[model samples]
Target: MLKDRNITLTVPAMPEYVDLVRLTLYGIASKMKFTFEDIEDMKVAVSEACNNAVLHAYDKDDGTIEVRFAFVKDELSITVRDYGSSFTIEENKETPAMHGKSIDEIQSGGLGLYLMQALMDRVEVEHGGGTAVTLTKKRQRTEEPA
Candidate 1:
């Protein structure tokens, strides 16, 4: 049996550091036998979370973003946390005007939450003094030839 494991990393709140998160995720997920498609989904989900922290966390001051990866049984849970300004998903919900508008007509931002939810098996957001987004993905088992 594989023992449960946790890996944590802290990076400066910057756009460039998001790629480091993705690289770490890929390395760990690949070792756990996650499918390529699933890994890609996770990468996108994690990237979105990191991007949110880098862009919205810390209004006028520098801060750090903490990423925690926990492996339990067949599930992988990733938490991206930032100790800075906080916001709610409701505040970023899509507007009615954006419904019928074309892609170019619509805005370029505010899709991170949707992307995270769509790509991950579960997404939980907590905020008070800061924001924490936890994304979970379950590993799919493959049947072996008998």
Candidate 2:
């Protein structure tokens, strides 16, 4: 069975804090034995989520972004929350009427949310007093030699 561990961090809602989140995620994912590619994907997804919160969550520069990291065995889950705009995960996943269009053609800013959903095994968004995005990804299990 996988063990569950969690860490929480609150930082200023600024672009500079994105690197702090990336580093913290790298450490947790490394301990969970995530592959290099998986680590890369997680970093990108987490960064996107954080960026969204920083850009949309606060009108003044006084708010903070709360990041929570949870490790469940080979799976790592991240939650990014901000007290700003409200958004739905389902709404963000819709594609324009046109199919096979390049990302540039889509023109909607929710592409980051779409990419996060694609990269993570699970993605959920909650909006109340704040907006929170939960992302989960599992590490590939390795076989033991008999």
Point to the candidate with the largest TM-score: 1
User: What RMSD, rounded to one decimal, does every model reach?
Assistant: 1.7, 2.8
Cα lDDT of model 1 by residue, 80-136, tens digit: 999999997778864446777888898766888888889999999998779999999
lDDT of 2 by residue, 17-136 (tens): 999999999988887788999999999999999999988888888989999998876778899999886777677556566478877776656688879988999998889988999999
lDDT of each: 0.90, 0.88
Task: Show the colliding residue pairs in model 2.
Answer: none
For residue 74, what is the lDDT in candidate 2? 74
